[model samples]
Target chain A: MSRVHDMGGRYGDGAVNPADNATFAQDWHARALALTLAAGALGQWNIDVSRHARETLSPKDYSRFSYYEKWLAGLADMLVNLGVLTREELKAGHATGVSELASRILKADAVAGVLAKGSPYTRDGAPNAEFKPGDRVKTRRPAHNIQVAGGHTRLPGYASGLIGEVVLLHGAHVLPDSNAHGLGEAAEPLYAVAFAARDVWGDEAGAWDEVVLDLWQSYLEPTA
Target chain B: MHFRAGQTRATSANLAAMPHDHDHDHPHTLLPPEPALRVRALETILTEKGLIDPAALDEIIETYQHKIGPQNGAKVVARIWSDPTFRKGMLDEPMPLLEELEFYGRQGEHMVIVENTPEVHNVVVCTLCSCYPWPLLGIPPGWYKSDAYRSRVVREPRKVLAEFGVDVPDDKKVRVWDSTAEVRYLVVPERPEGTEGMDEDALAALVTRDSMIGTGLALRPEA
Candidate 1:
């Protein structure tokens, strides 16, 4: 819940810059994006795992790296952790020796096809939704169990422990909480849960405002 | 020059903003004042190890930079308005519509289109990370992923929307979609009253990138 990346409602950040619309602020931003996507195609890790890797970076590194820079750093950490490449190769700017596991390098000819044909996260035959539209529910506060305290969770700290209502049933989809830790994919029913902005932010929020979250079933508890 | 661990996420951005005073004190910037060089070095390492293809990286960049972007999303939103069949197709299930228009791709595989109306207005944000619909809207704008946005929009959507020159009246409820899991959201702005005669391309022109993200209202017919 205290993860630096779980940044919702934490204040003192300045105004949102609508004029700052550039997709990539620097030349390296483009490279960082492509490199991360290309390297990810090697089949060693899923998007969830990569996100968890990024979230797990030291707080200083997390705060220091620009968004795309974080992508590059996370890519490096995952590559080394997964043994796809070594620390020496990264530091030396050359391979000390050929990587033994060159399992599924994405080729130029196949890049467009691979990107166009994105892998769908919905598992087959998985439609056991427990909640329906208009059903009230409360986001489960993190239990803080010793075993499960510090892994990646999609539930933002601000919305946790807050009561909300299911706005839409999104069927079943891959759960990041389990998948991020190499615990294997589990498709949980995902719903759009709407929390009143006043409840989420107290009296300062607009009277008619609400925040909706795409939450998995495990993150929600049925409320009276 | 180690930043205190307690510095807010904006510290890096703040440091970047104040170049005259901060740049000299901090010799290393961008985590390596040479981000381009660092990226090049990583590419070289990956290519040499047969771990990646440089041309593939170029392809990825080419696709995002030129082949697709917010314009693709414009076409989708315009279609939803100009064509009732397309609108129903989009509302019933968006995948086929996305495919029919060739707007389907990564970061956009799982999409839920939320429509705006007189009673309620919807906006999208990613509180945990920048989870955006890449193929439909291209890479998200920098502000969409900023600490200010990710931290504030969900809590005060009307205020955030107001900052973007969008004002939701108190009578009109505002909903902010925090895309946390695999789902990516595209907010369909309400069609203006007089656009019934507007052709598809004409309608498409009114759909600004921010409009689809629910941060701003779609441009009026004149715009």
Candidate 2:
């Protein structure tokens, strides 16, 4: 939650410009996305790892770079850190030698099939959900204890520790906090917790507004 | 050698007025090469390293650029409005119907559909990242992924909605779904009145991309 990426209810921002809807503003954006995704298909890392790498950027870089720029930086870091490439190679803007990952390249023909068959996080053998719909519950302050959470968490700062009722139980899914690190996919039950806007934002919030978050069970307190 | 304060001010004023004060000496090569060059460089490096195929990259870009997009979501919304069975089916368990309709894949693996009604308005946001239903709606628009929309939408839905000219009534309970997990959401905007005679194709025409995202409503039929 302390990360720059955990932005919710922070103020002093301009309007949401509704004019530009082009998928990619520049020729490079499309290429950047494609390159990241192609490299991702190498099967070396998961989406959670990619997300953590992207957010792990410096605060200034996180805030300053355009969206895909951050993605490019993350991809470069991930490739280098994974030993698929080297810093000197990137600096030279050329490959010193062919990578061993050649045997695992994502061919053009496989792109459609791979995208169509998306990597679904849902898995079998989930335990019974602890809390049911309409049960009043509170999210644990996992973020406050950042050292314990290991830096990658799905629960944003704005909605942390808020008291809310379980609006829906979405069965069990991969826990991003653990999955992001090499901690393994500790699949846990996820629920939609609805917090009243008035409770979260106080007077600034509209009386009838409510925010619902899809939070994993690990983020919720054991008791109601 | 530096001049005294008063002397420097006069010299600076004169220099500012002068046409050639070292300005013409250097051509504007201040910027590095455009991003295109860097992007090409990266692509070439990866390709040469045998880590990626330029063809695959092209296929990925081409698919997103042409094959997938909001039009798919528009068609789904139209079918939802025109067919009662499909609307109920979609609301109850969207995956089956979406898979049948082929609006299933990629970032939209785990899908959820929320309907907007006269009494309740629904909107979707991802405060952490841009977790969108890409198969149905394509890549998210700039505003949808922006800080202003992400930070304030959950706390102040109406204000952000107003930014897109969508004014939720005071009596209408606004429900903002912050996609914290991988589940992606699509808002089935309320069908506008006076569209009784329209077919699904015609109805799909009325569905704007923003309507499916809950920032705006479907276009009303002409009077």
Highest-lDDT candidate: 2
* DockQ comparisons of all candidates to the true complex: 0.33, 0.25
TM-score of 2: 0.90
For model 1 the TM-score comes to 0.90
Give the worst 10-residue stretch by lDDT in candidate 2 chain A. A142-151
Q: What lDDT tens digits, residue by residue, belong to model 2 across residues A68-147?
A: 87777667766665667676777778899898768878999999988887777776677668899888888877454242
Model 1, residue pairs in steric clash: none
Per residue, candidate 2 scores C-alpha lDDT tens digits across B1-223 of 0111122111223212322113222111121245566577778889999988999999999999999999999999999998899989988888888888888778988888899999889999999888889999998888888888888888788988998989988889999999988888999999999999799999999998899888989999862
Q: What is the DockQ of candidate 1?
A: 0.33
Q: Write the per-residue lDDT of candidate 1 for residues A1-224, one digit (tens) a residue.
A: 47788889988888999988998888789998989888777666677767876777767767877888778777776666566666566656778866665656788998878888877877756658889999999987862212245766788878879899998888888777766554546688989998888898899987878888888888888987
What would the per-residue lDDT of candidate 1 be over residues B172-201, giving only the tens digit for each residue? 888888888778899999998778889889
- Model 1: residues >4 Å from true position, as ranges? A125-127, A143-147, B1-33
